[model samples]
Target: MDAQPDPVGEPAGSLDPRAELSEFLRTRRARLKPEDVGLPDFGRHRRVPGLRREELSQLAGVSVAYYTRLEQGNGRNVSAEVLDSIARALRLTDAEHAHLTHLAKPKLKKKQSGACAQQQQPVRPALRGLLDTMDSVPAYVSGWRTEILAWNRMAAAVFGDWGELPPQERNWARLVFLRPDYRDLFIDWEQKAIDIVCMLRMNAGRCSDDPRLASLVGELSVKSEDFRRLWATHDVKEKSFGVKRLHHPLVGDLSLQYESFRLTDGTEQALVTYHAEAGSQSEESLRLLASWGTDASRAGSSVRRTA
Candidate 1:
């Protein structure tokens, strides 16, 4: 990451993902004071902490001036040597180290939509087949980026709102935070939003360099202040399986447990299916919802596509 700062903006259309990742890492590091990490926080009234450029330089075993240049994105040749030392000084976990390495590496300049980029949206045929077969349960396939690729009839019933939403707003995660109807649909709106935001943040980190992901982030950041704030926290958690409580307009309050499995052969989409404990009142409610969703799907059939 060594080079003089490009004026105005990236000579290309936008800022490099490396630039964004670097900024995030620097901000996160600078936010922590020495005392926050058990070192003395005695600088009285200073700028930032955890480590100053000089301190980080010492801890990372690199020269202060050189580190500064790297931070400034002027160090065009930041080898693995510097990154490894920096990770050690930051007490980074394995995942963090991997993310750091990703940030420092050269951009994958291949076209964002191509044979290699197939994983970006190539929903597996097998997963799609599974979704169709699971017409009895609320099931759908979505990629990490929260795209509603494909869903069974039952999926539409439980998440009926998605069926009504235009293509631009079919995102369950975004609706959970910004849509008025969605906020009121869940009895525990606050918790639901938090979980969705956390999951979305995790996906964003996993696909930070993706053009579609960048667009999604920009849209959500502009549309919801809550989304913007949650995103800044940098929390990452995969939400594959969980129990959710929702007050469906048609089926009343119901609890459903969902499980997600990543598809290996087809696309990078995850197949998520929601089920209720057999013989329980919640299960009965889910069945009713399933029936209603099936009826609706018949009236307005649309194929779900996942990438």
Candidate 2:
């Protein structure tokens, strides 16, 4: 029997879990200080920024040699207890802890026999209908890799008509980094960038075998220096809820709260919706924006009919 070739046109290779685990541990360790970990801060010329390998090993109650091997990216023989102790020593958050676990013990991928190209994420028609019904809210459906699978008119009005963008350019990461208009749209662009990069980092941990994700990461790394810096930090964040402060060209300032709910259809799909506080100026602005979007949509429809 001969080995089969990988799927055709897979432009990027899968992320190396060993390398990811190594960098993740190193970055996490680099951010901590001896004093912060309740260890004695010896006033000496130190080459490294944070606690030494030996100090960390001692804190985790493991042999220096074992901890060193794990930090060197050999997590093949790591135990659950050891991982937990090391996570505590590193002061990892819930999200970071999960990311660390995923990196250290990634699930075995099933052998691929045929086409392995990334499939287009399917958005349920009902979900799309739901988005359309949210006339006063800006809502959209995000699938794996944060792809904008479907969106309502209000979302188009607030976030720019994603329908106008080619499918590949509809991602949040690309829009945030590659689009200049988005930089102006987001009042706190740096924070938005950080959040996006962190989300990608978390996704990378969970979906190491996703070739499209690998390609996306590679593209951003090559094209955006800011992305490169943030990616190197190995930070991870789970998207749940947040407040977005946007400077809409037509509506001025908008402070909108967004909530994301995971779809229960056994898919990695989430419905994200944004709304303004009740009786607030932002709420008034949102209503005005919705009206403007409706009018524009009507005018476009009329023009198409005339043509």
Candidate 3:
């Protein structure tokens, strides 16, 4: 039987850096086999699922003792070259490699007062104006932890009005997992869940000390089994661009392609916009939805979900 996902034993958002690094490397190592690294797999029964410490160290050109200590969560003295070598050995993607580096060399946390820690990041007026100018495109600004800071009318029409939701509930993680209506809106709910969890994992590595993030992770871990399972996979990815299929209550169906651009405003905010292909049925449905304008309030009200 597969091992169960470890519980969020620490308080929400307060994951130990060492433990995070340890589990991430272990999960990554567990997915590989000796044959994967060109090593002969003798018919001897294996004691562990994936490559052993000696095998990985040999592949990475590092000492077995050092690799063992690093895998055991003592990565403080590890260098970038060693990390890069190990990343290559594990065949980690760019995003996964970056996540590993962050876990190993976390930035110093700034002291935050109670109010400052919980304060919401405001979308710049210029950025908000840019979102508004994208008339036909459904656009929104997301801050750290996938918080929906600002959105345009088209976005509200397709994804429900974030303006109506409390700031805490205006997050992608909360909307996708906590709200039943949002779950039903996605055609591939499992894929959507995986994407959201991957985003959260990225955020956890980047801002592991954010208490609000910890609290959100803790709450989701306790409330949603799907969240708990996906969270344990140690997957790290950014949803920079993708196609999403949705079963909109009013529009019937929508196939939208989205692009995410990072803002250069010295903050961790991204501008995400969605558009359907020109002259396609999805385009027509999107156009019709946009035409609903303020009237889409009715559809939003119909599918409004409560936590």
Candidate 4:
């Protein structure tokens, strides 16, 4: 099948939703097998990997030509029912299902001038206060571009002092790919790195015109071979609740659960909070770290008073 061309009159760096949707569908289809989906294999030689287009179409209860059109990026005004059927046939996770829907129906692009005028807004005062009050949990607010907008003292204590870095250097993707220390912090560094890039890819799909995000992706692609390889895979994922295993310089190995809450206000910022299970060794480590952070703050204040 011929590949779909880029949308006419679109800029070189702008995203093509149709192309994205096609690639996403193709890749997902490539990963499945006939046996995996409870289909019989007749030992027939196949030219391509995974289930054939006809097989997928049969499983999805759609005509092969119709399914092929969707996979080829020619299906316009695709109904939700069809998408849901396709999603079930592919056995997609919740995150993957949502991503498929986003690709199928991307938001209408805002004018370039309006988008360019947009800037990262400040975290609300109440939200800042909320972070301050969460002394026991390490929490931070991140912009849609994964920019570290605001972090609490506990967050600083756990994840280095992001405030010390320049605004451009405070991004999650930059920290993972550029900083050796941050890369070493995670136990599963390779997987963690891939997830970071995947999340960035998802962001790119949603806000392709964001100059800052585009610049960051370009910089990383140029600097890090790992980032370049992963970005080429076209993997996309949204950050959700998960367990993180990390080795901090001060604290030892810690296994923490993180939950991300979306802010109701217009901004797409999310409040990410990390906590250890009560009575677990990780909880003890967190307590020690919190105490150390508190003492360090007190000492700094005392020195300022003495001066």
Candidate 5:
């Protein structure tokens, strides 16, 4: 009843999702402040930004080897009590904690046997209205898989072409690695790609058993070596609100601030919007983008999504 290698054993790409989950939980623990978790420091020379795996093991009252195995996704049949202890030690937020538990033991075996694990279907109409209301910032809604479900005119202008792609190919991960335009569009494409890999790692833990999620990974594995390597490393991170550099053909380059608002009623679908400070260069760039979008809007160039 536990996660195991299939007959002939699935390739690392197939079982790599578990490795991803483990790495994320382990990495998150490694990056925590001892003070945040009520742990006393020994005044040792700190060489790393986060807590050591040994320290995490001690805090969680588990053997270092055992914890290491968990992090590598080698050990299964973990107890809920231990998972709780690790969660507490990590000082994870409620959502993070729930996600951690889900990673430790997928819901498919029991919890998802009959219960409704899915959130509200698709993006809410009210949310779409809100996206339309935004004056200039590009706004869009995307599910956990980075399936871009909806977007406004400004968003349509920026990543507008993506909406024209098939749903399976429209995934942010795919676009970051597979699309030729990604390199030209992102000023810091490498960092952005790394960030997407990390974020996708976090999602992999929460949705490892989801068929759609599996399909996305399978498709990416077959098509993108970048995605394949990063997914194999099993890294995960949380990057919600931040500044990003973008290169637009019409507006040149600009630094934009963005915020990700998660909808509780949806399936962790997020609304991300980017804006420039009132007097920032990005503001001018955004105006140019808006102007371009207005022109596209007038042309009635509605991009139809693929898949």
Candidate 6:
């Protein structure tokens, strides 16, 4: 009748859902203004940046003490009705509401035998072939943890030679936080870094027990001040479609739109493809980059055969 020990070196602790909920609520509350939420300004100087606890409780039709407890992470059995009312008072978007619910009720961690027990599934040959066929676009496959599982030649040309890195170093978040070259590559580096952290925070909720993810987060937190600051904001975001601006060393500035699709093959993988608008300067730059990549690949192959 004793509790079992957690898997080896998997960290001595798991994520604290209540703490996450508290931080998220605080940040969201701080971002709202009295006038923005249809509350009257009494012309009195305010100490806080956003609505007061009493003001929020009044708007949500809840008692100040109860809302205070919720904000303090002590509302153990918050009902759906109360949550909905709070969401409405906060004027949360659909994504924000879902994220609030997740923070309030995080998924339970799964028991794993060991750190290496959960091996990454191999990318399907068909998917790899599909990537290769996208000669004009940059594409790659990523796992649930945002690690690059597979990438095409165009992806390498556009995003640097990912194949040169070890598998553990090929992660998107890792490249964003740990590599100066990647930071220099993006024109909107600050926004991109924040978005990457938000996506990682969202994934951390679902995979709190994954050692690889935990390690990545810890490393970033310790190494990058920006990562630490953004991570504390408790933002959550899903990576879907978005526009990115990159300043490739070989091709100058380019604007690319990316789409992400979940794979059907049950491995919880996603295929992300990046493309430029037709007949645009970015499209021409992409073509030039792809040609350079192709020539470089062939030269490397020839050298390997000579060796």
Best candidate, TM-score: 3
Worst 10 residues of 6 by lDDT: 1-10
Per-residue accuracy of model 3 over 33-137 as CA lDDT, tens digit each = 988889999878878789888889999999999998888889887889999999999989999998888788764332211222444457778887888788799
Instruction: Give candidate 4's whole-model lDDT.
Output: 0.75
lDDT, candidates in the order shown: 0.62, 0.79, 0.80, 0.75, 0.67, 0.75
- TM-score of each prediction: 0.72, 0.89, 0.91, 0.83, 0.71, 0.84
Q: Which parts of model 4 are misplaced by more than 4 Å?
A: 1-12, 107-117, 294-307
Reference-based lDDT, residue 82, model 2: 93
Per residue, candidate 4 scores C-alpha lDDT tens digits across 238-275 of 78889999876666699999998877676767899999
Per-residue accuracy of model 2 over 274-302 as CA lDDT, tens digit each: 99999999999888878887554444334
Alpha-carbon shift of residue 200 in model 3 (angstroms): 0.8
Between candidates 4 and 5, the TM-score winner: 4
Model 1 quality (TM-score): 0.72
Residue ranges of candidate 1 with Cα displaced over 4 Å: 1-15, 49-51, 54-61, 74-76, 79-85, 88-96, 107-122, 187-209, 277-281, 291-307
Q: In model 3, where do residues sit more than 4 Å from their true spots?
A: 1-13, 108-119, 304-307
3 versus 5: better TM-score goes to: 3
Worst 10 residues of 5 by lDDT: 1-10
Q: What local lDDT score does residue 225 receive in model 6, on the 0 to 100 scale?
A: 91
The sequence of per-residue lDDT tens digits that candidate 6 reaches over residues 1-307 is 0111112234435556677778778888988899998999998998878989999999999999999889987646787789899999998877677677656654322321122225457788888889888888899988766778888888877776666666667778878888777787789999899888877787666555556567777777888998998898877777789999987766679999999897766666789999999999999998887778766444433433343
lDDT for residue 12 in candidate 5, whole number 0-100:
34
Output the lDDT of residue 152, model 6. 87
- Which prediction has more favorable lDDT, 2 or 3? 3
TM-score-better candidate, 2 vs 3? 3
The worst-scoring run of ten residues by lDDT in candidate 4 lies at: 1-10
Candidate 3 accuracy as TM-score: 0.91
Clashing pairs in 2: none
